[model samples]
Target: MIPLVDLQTQYKSIQPAIDAAALRVLASGEYLGGPDVSAFEQGFAEYCNVGHAIAVNSGSSALHLSLLGAKVGPGDEVITSPFGFVATTAAICATGARPVFVDIDPLTFNLDPAGLADAITPKTKAIMPVHLYGLMADMDPIMSIARQANIAVIEDACQAHGALYKGKRAGSIGLSGSFSFNPGKNLSAVGRGGMVVTNDDEQAQFLRRLRDWGQDGRYNHVHQGFGYCMDTMQAAILNVKLRHLEHWTELRRAHARRLTCQLKNSAVTTPPEPHCCRHVYQVYAVRSASRDLLRAAIATRGVDSGVHYPRPVHLQQAYAGLGYMEGDFPEAERAAAEMLSLPISPELTDSQIDYIAAAVWSDAWRPRAATANLGVKSTRDLARPAQEQSEQAA
Candidate 1:
């Protein structure tokens, strides 16, 4: 079966290098705050074209640290889109700041800058725009709005490792950017890891102290900080993975282009990559009115699919106290009901992509009742040759 992400296949491809990195870290007896972590922080900072990168324990910690560094605290409000992982809101809440929800642009699935200005208030401390599904948010207007309001703009760039917006790297646009090295991400570690990138020297210094028990030095407590240091082994593994991220990103983009072309005439709406951006296709999601039915249909044909978020953060049970209702953010709710993430692993072959596209196209147009009797067509019958498909897509 075609899984959404095949980490096993990815691991097998570079087992020796990964094993060696991990073993070297193990042999050194440095599991935390070592040369490995320092090297990775430097490598990641250079990769994002930023001045500093502070490695953290998780993406959530990265966001939280950045918020605290921005001086966002209780009674402050952080403006962001409601259509994202709960970690974004959680990070804001951890900083004792309230998260203000804004509707997203239906096409780009990023925060709509039009609503951004209105969302600002006396209490608005920072604007955290999430770069969802490997696509960078429209930053020009967001940055302009933030500048006019004189508030910091932090990027929740956990899913957007190499995405580019108007030629600027995802994590390098705002005051600071947070990234995740969760195994499923484009630049993943073997386990959970994260980083915060910034050009602000003061902010970087603050974050470095904050992630390590608020210490200015060993046993010298400067401020009350949490334990958010990245494991040295995880950093070493990530360093190895970082070397291959650009190539993998290109492969993902190529696969996404072909998938979008193949599904051009299908019932579902394909994801769009605007001319001003370069999408890494971390999750090649499509919108379908009958999302649940379509998912089931594709499953019968050996294809698998997923929903990035079946529920918006504002509508989640944990955030019910936020006092939001079903229709508060129409676009976010609509996307929650329709979005379906398909497999876009770099390891995927052209034939696999064609088969996946054919399955989706064929079932997307069929009736729900007909799906039970799914006269499944062989890949040979349903899929066109790669060259023919490319030309047709052209």
Candidate 2:
């Protein structure tokens, strides 16, 4: 079966380099906040074309630290998309700031810039726009709006590691941006890892301090902070993978292009690639009126599919106190019901993509009754993470 992301295949392709890096880190006896982390941070900063990149334990930490560095607090509110992963809202809430929900652009599935003005209030201190899937958000207008309002803009760029918007890298386009290096991401680390990039020197300093127990010096604490530093081993692994990012990104783009071309006439709606942005295709999701049935049909053909999120943040039980109800954000609610992610990775072969597309096409045209009669159990029913699916495939 084709898995959403093939991390095992990626690991095998760079086994020698990975082994050497791991061995070097293990033998050095210097782990936390060591030379390896510094080197990786430098490389990452250069890659994002930003002045600083602070390595953190996970992307969620990166967002929380960014919000803290921006001075967002309990009385403030941060405007953000309702359609994205819960982490975006979680990070804002962690800063003791309320996350103001905004609708998404149906075409790009990213936060709608037009909604920003309406959501801003005197208490709105920042706007966090998520570059969903792999496409960068339309930052030109969003930045303009933020500047006019004198509020900060933090990009939630976890799914768009190497994406570009109007030629600027995703992480460098705003006041600060966060990325996830989870094993299934475009630039996966050995394990959980993340980074925050920014051009502001003061903000960078704040982020550094916030990630390390607010230490001004050895055993001297200045402010309350939590442990969030990236481990030496994770940094080394990511540094090695960073060099091959462009090549792998191109491969993902090529696969997405082919898939879109082949499925253009099918019932599924292909994800859009805006002209002013470069989409890295982290997850090639499609929309269908009959998504559930289509996914079951695809599964019958031995192809695995996934739903990036079956529910939007506003509708989640955890956020019930937010007072959001159905139809509060129409587009996001619609997308939550229909979006289905197909297998997309640099390791995917042409034949595999073709087969997956054909399966989708065949199932999309079938009658609902016909599809139901196939008797194939939906992969979604099993609900395994991409990493788990990769291991099972192996």
Candidate 3:
């Protein structure tokens, strides 16, 4: 079976360096916010081309701190895309701010910059767009709207490790951005971790305090803050991974390009990389009329797959208070139904990809017929039985 992400391969490749770093940290006896973490902060900041980076326990904590550092609180609203992980919205709500769900551009699966104004209210204080699936959103329009409205823009770059828009790094384009280093991510650590990158020196300073119980010095509790500090262990592991990130990202891109070539004529609609942005392809998600059937078939063929989001955030059980219902954001709703992520991880092999391609060409999956209301591109032309299409329509 082809694994979704082969962390074991990465782990073994750098086991010696990683083991040594972990051992050195163990010998130091300074676990939290030690020299290793500070060194990692410097390295990651230089990697992102940002002036500062504040490490945290998880991506959610990074988002939480970025909000507090920017002074987001109750009665304020932050506009972000609904087609993303719940953490992106959960972080905003944690800061006592309301989350305003915006639609996504069908092409990039990122927040639609054109839809920003319609979702904005006087209470809107920020636009926190996730670089979903490791693809950078259209920064030009989002930045344009933000500057006109004077709203702070915080990028949720948890998935996009090194994705670029217009040749600028993803996390550095906005006021600041949050990153995750979970084992599944492109630039992953052994377990869990996150980082916040920004050019604002004041916010950077405050965020460091925010993650450490708001104290300027040891045992001097200056203000009430949560214990969300990043430790030396995860940093040590990540620093080792950081050295090989570019090479791994390139490999992932190569895998994605090869898979894209094979899937170009398959039943699934392969997502294309936009010229202006380098899509690192953290997920090579395809759209299809038979998303369920194709996914089940793929899984049975000894390959793993997943849905980046099975449902949009606004219509989620937790967000009913936001007063949204079905059909509010048609593009996002359409995407939720047909989006399928194939095995596009760093460790997928050529033969396994060929098997996936062959399986997709078999009888288990079939395309849908022409529906006037169909919004998912390339689903209308596949050959599906009329009866199956009717059942799905109902």
Candidate 4:
């Protein structure tokens, strides 16, 4: 079966290097806050053209810490798109700040800057624009608005490691950027990991302290903080993986081009890579009105698909107190119903890409009556591994 992300195949391709990195960390007996973590942070900062990178245990922690570092707290509101992973909003809530929902651009699936100005109130402390599906948000306008409002912009670059917006890398474009190293991400570690990148010295230093129990020195706590340090082993694995990231990103881009070429003229709408942006295609999501049916049909042909988020955060039961109704963010709501991610792992063969495209194109246009009983499994069951499926359910 063609899985949405073939992490097993990717791991096998670089097994020797991965094993050596893990062993080296094991031999050193420095499992946390070691040289490996420092080295990886430096390497990643250089890679993103940023001045500092503070490693963390997960993407969620990266976001939470970044928000706190930016001094976002109670009585503040963080503006962001509702059409993204819930972590984006959760991070804001974790900072004791309100998460204000903005609709997304129909094409880019990123935050719409046009709606941004209206959302900013005196309570707005920061604007966190998520780079949804590896495409950087339209930052020029977003930055202008933020600057006018005198607010900080924190880029959610978790899915956009190598993405570029006007020649600037994803993590370098905002006041600060957060990234995830989940095993399925474009530049992943063997396990959960994350980073916060920025050029601001003060913010960088604050993040460094915050991730390690707010320590100025050993046993000397300077600020209230949480235990969010990145494991040395994961950092070492990421160090090895970082060397191959650019190449893998190119491969993903090429695969995206192939799929777009094959499906451009079809009924479904392909993801757009704007002229000012270089999308990394971490998730090659396409849009169709009948997404559930199309996904089920594709699965029947041995191709799995996924929905980045099946529901908008504002409408979720967890955020019911936010008081946002179903039609509050129409663009976001529409995207949640229509966007479907196909298999686009760098390890996929050309033939596999062709097969996936064929499956999508064929099923996308099939008669509704013929597709009624395509043995539809939920996207979660088809796209994710059993372990991930169980974890998500939990």
For candidate 4, the lDDT comes to 0.87
10 residues in a row with least lDDT, candidate 1: 372-381
lDDT of 3 by residue, 69-158 (tens): 778999999999989889999999999999998888775678887778988899998999899888888888889999999999999999
Number of the candidate with higher lDDT, 1 or 3: 1
- Candidate 2 lands at a TM-score of 0.92
Residue-level lDDT of model 4, residues 1-394, one tens digit each, is 8999988888899999999988888888889887888999999999999999999999999999889988999999999999888999999998889999888877778888888989999999999999988999988888999999999999999999989988999979788999999978999987899999999999999889889999999989999989999999999999989999999998998888777877756757777766667889989998877888888888889998899889999999999998899999987897888888999999998899889888977844473443221332211112335564344223
Badly placed stretches (over 4 Å) of model 3 are: 369-394
Sum up the clashes in candidate 3. Answer: 0
lDDT of 1 by residue, 172-267 (tens): 989999999998899998789999999999999999999999999899998999999999999999999999999999899888888898887577
Considering lDDT, which of the candidate structures 1 and 4 is the better prediction for this target? 1
TM-score, model 1 to reference: 0.93
- The clash number for model 2 is 0
What is the C-alpha lDDT profile of model 2 across 1-394, one tens digit per residue?
9998899999999999999999999999988878899999999999999999999999999999989988999989999999978999999999899999988887677888888899999999999999999998888889999999999999999999889987999989889999999888899987799999999999898888879999878778888998999999999999899999999999998888888878866777777766567889999999875778888999988899999878999999999998999999987887788888999899999999999998997844463432111222211122446664344233
Best of the candidates, TM-score: 1
lDDT of each: 0.89, 0.87, 0.83, 0.87
User: TM per model?
Assistant: 0.93, 0.92, 0.92, 0.92
lDDT of 2: 0.87
Candidate no. 3 TM-score: 0.92
TM-score of 4: 0.92
**CA deviation > 4 Å runs, candidate 2:** 364-394
